[model samples]
Target chain A: MTATQLSPGRVRKTPAGAAAPGRRRAFDRYLNPVLGAVGVAVVLASWQICASTGVVDPKFSSSPSGAFGALVDSFKSGDVWSPLGSTLSIVAWGMVISIVAAIPLGLLIGRNRVLYALTDPLISIMYSVPYVVFLPMLIFWFGIGADARVVIVVWSALFPLLINVIAGARNLEQSHLQVSRVFCASRLMTLRSVAFPATLPYILAGVRQAVGRALIGAIVAELFMGSAGLGYVVQLKTSNFQTDDAMAAIAVIAVIAVLLNHGVAYLEQRLTFWSRTD
Target chain B: MNDPRRKLVVDDLRIGHWSRRSGTFALACDGLTFDVAENAFVAIVGPSGCGKTTFLTALAGLIPVESGRLELNGEQISGPSRDRSLVFQQASLFPWRNVVANIEFGLKAQGRLDAEGRARVAELVELVGLSGKEDKYPRELSGGMSQRVNLARALATDPDLLLLDEPFSALDAQTRELMQEELTRVWQADSAGSGKTAVFVTHDVPEAVFLADRVIVLSSGPAHLVEVVEVNLPRPRGPEVKRSPEFQEISDYILSLVMSQNKPGRRTEDHDSNAALSR
Candidate 1:
């Protein structure tokens, strides 16, 4: 064979195939961030124009500048950080609890047909019943504290994570499992080497969706019962007719959701780099 | 051509399975017996759905032998072990693993190799002519290259008996021919002093004739060995041997047996005679 035939890299570098390494690198460095910034600017400009021109009442549809002004005032008032911190802490703890509890349950249910069948009805019922309706009962039990908010967040996050993980684990190819058997891999080794890695992308996607749901759950719980958090602040402002402050809190929640989704996506990309190339 | 010095023996092997969807026992093989001698390359050929896969699986102990005995080196085969290695038709390399990692799978399972396993993996990769593609994933490989990796992975364990189930069936004709040559080179290298035994399954007549010390033709399902034709052609055999009259005669004889079995009630046709000679 010639040197060109022996070298796999040269074959990949050929035109009309995948992009050259140098070109891909350049695109990564120069184009992605610029395009992202332009996208954000355009959305903000449209929002600002609509609000400032009174396409809707400024009282209801707060401009980008109006929301920023409210954010600055809230910061000056010295109470902003505590509520934001509280909200973040609840979200973080709730996510940890959800992951710890849901993944094992999902794997168990995924692998065993009997367990899955037994739990199917209960999970469907839990998923169908909006936890918002159970807020009063939760307050009666946990008494409107951070614990209660966390409980609500867990309720919201658990089912999607459970369902996706179960599906992922169950969907593992029989051929891969046969390979494991042929090699006589120990049960633990098979789970670690084959089961876990294969199901990681699906689990990561579930976590992404769960993070958004958890935020909504936490905020909703706080809105109904608590005197602190971004949701509480929104409730307080809206009740007092401070529409700009309420909209600002809502905007912050949107930004938080976007950031969490993107963060999970980045983690998924890193964990499943092999999958992407394939 | 029954060999007196047999390295592996399967006696009265019967393999059948009850189809879960159809709820009927589908008989794949019935009353099959064969013997492969030490350092021998034995090829089994049959048409599609002729229980070729089932027979190979039975020998590898992947499927349970319903009522038969499979002896390897005079020991009754029980289950999959390090002593016997199989190369499947599809490469079936773990997509998550790279080439080197895949080759080390059996060793890792046996817990015989340590961190120094990379050295042995490098040797096999070189043997398969995949030296620099060690870090490449299976999906990155072409069909031929992936099959090469599969062959390397099976050989890495250094098994006494190698069982290949139509291992090169997926490659194109040209690539398949090249791979057959590569396989012969590898087999000869292994057989030099070690006396490695191989059982290769294929449907291609020329492939069986080129690669085997003996070619065993199986009848259609319920399949059993119809003939075991000894190929006394000399090696290192080249592409030119395929054109020799001796090669043609043996090829024609095996093809006649296979064709005759396919149409048991009818007189053998001129098409069968011409087709067998043409290849």
Candidate 2:
């Protein structure tokens, strides 16, 4: 009764006989980026030094500034945007398709023992085979068109999302499920209230993996008989012995991948806030 | 000692699970025949692995009965129903849901939750002494606080029979004692109004004696009802009741019964006493 009179926040602030909140390590939040920046600076400096001192052949290795110059040149020429756009579109659609298809399938498989028994082996086999190894088959089937690239991206992205989602559903806490049953909750109600929210953190984790794989899939697909993506630009430039231009394209792709991953991570943190605190 | 308005009846009930690892049926409890009168607080005590949880699950209709009869309010208990709400040992509050939202979960599931339901939840929050912590998520709560939310949530549905499975076992001793007191208060509150019957399961003898009007003891591994000792101690029980001679005597008696059941190849000294009581 006394505890109720004070706000819950103050109750938390004024720890009773219960456990006190654990103090975070010094500079916990800022330490990661600060250390990361220092590491990146060292790598960049070493690369610049190597390129400048001619320790590595310029034909094979472009200095950071040279790559930057090529990046500006490509942008000014107005030719890079379309390829960049194509790559982005491919990744976006591929991830969307994978997520939409995988989550429901994962839920079904996770919930249904019969369905899981029947398809589990097939799923495992498909997952085991590196999806990129299917590039030749995809190109042959879809004939080097955007269809082939999209298929490759979808294939690459699908398994991680599916596996993680299945895991999420499968690993649902028995106690939570029991709570639902005790209430006589409908199946749909149980799914919405317990299963879906419980699986969210796992699903977000899957998305993180899917984003990385889908991006790689898009680029890899473009490398094989494609003409309108950043990967194509990189391939085209490299084959023509334009290492700086190829490096520039690679740089853009890396930045995009990092940003996309960070975006998903931020969303994951916001949505599954309980996981962090718990 | 007997009431005409019986809320529950479990006669010759045999409960078990199919052990896939061993490919055999494992019995948890058999011949669990008992009647809980309306508004009675019944506590079940037994050794660890005595199917206390399994018994609760059976009452909740989570697990199917192998061969037995279970009736609630003159109706056959077939499956999990909203009429019987359960509070698990762990708080089992949805990690994603805040305290108030968790309390509202059962109401929301039944679709009976409305603006008026908010007041019901608020009442439960106060009843469990968790009024201010309504918005805090389960993660933000200590073990005792989470279990309070769990109890509040169970009470939300206004169930006919409240099934509890050692709901305070996970808390520290002090917190557990506090929770026991809180539960007695809540039960007293419900006692006057709906007369909600509760079957509380625990291994703690003192806890059983303090809260229950009657404590049912079971033997482990294919658990059988061994004894049901009535606590003649005064009600509106507080911490002072725990120190009373009557409370200590009953607690010691149940402890002796439980300890005897745990000893391998030892004769049960209270067997005749239990059989005579049942008769």
Question: Candidate 2 regions off by >4 Å?
Answer: A1-35, A53-60, B1-4, B20-22, B191-194, B219-221, B259-263, B266-279
Candidate 1 lDDT, B1-279, residue by residue in tens: 334377798788887766554666666678889888888889998755667777777677667767776788877777777788888777778877888888888778778567566676777788788878999988788988988888877777778888887888889988998899888887776532443689998878889999999999988766788989999999988888889999999999988887766755432232321121111
For candidate 1, give the lDDT of residue A108.
73
- lDDT by residue (B1-279, candidate 2, tens digit) is 234456688789898777655666767788887788788899999887777777777788877788887888877788889888999877778888899999999999999899878789988888889978978988889899999999989999888788988899889999999989989988888532654789999889999999999999988757888988998888788899988888888899999999888877533232322221111
Q: Which pairs of residues clash in candidate 1, taking residues 3 or more apart in a chain or in different chains?
A: none
DockQ for every prediction shown: 0.32, 0.47
Tens digit per residue, CA lDDT, model 1, A72-164 = 887889767888888888999999999999887887787789998999889878877886888888889999888888998998988878877
Q: TM-scores, in order shown?
A: 0.86, 0.87
Give model 2's docking category. acceptable
lDDT of 2 by residue, A45-105 (tens): 8999999999997789888888889999989998789999999999999998998999889
Report how far off residue B53 is in candidate 2 (Å): 2.9
- DockQ-based class of model 1: acceptable
Model 1 regions more than 4 Å off: A1-57, A75-78, B1-4, B190-195, B264-279
Model 1 reproduces what portion of true contacts?
0.39
lDDT of 1 at A202: 69
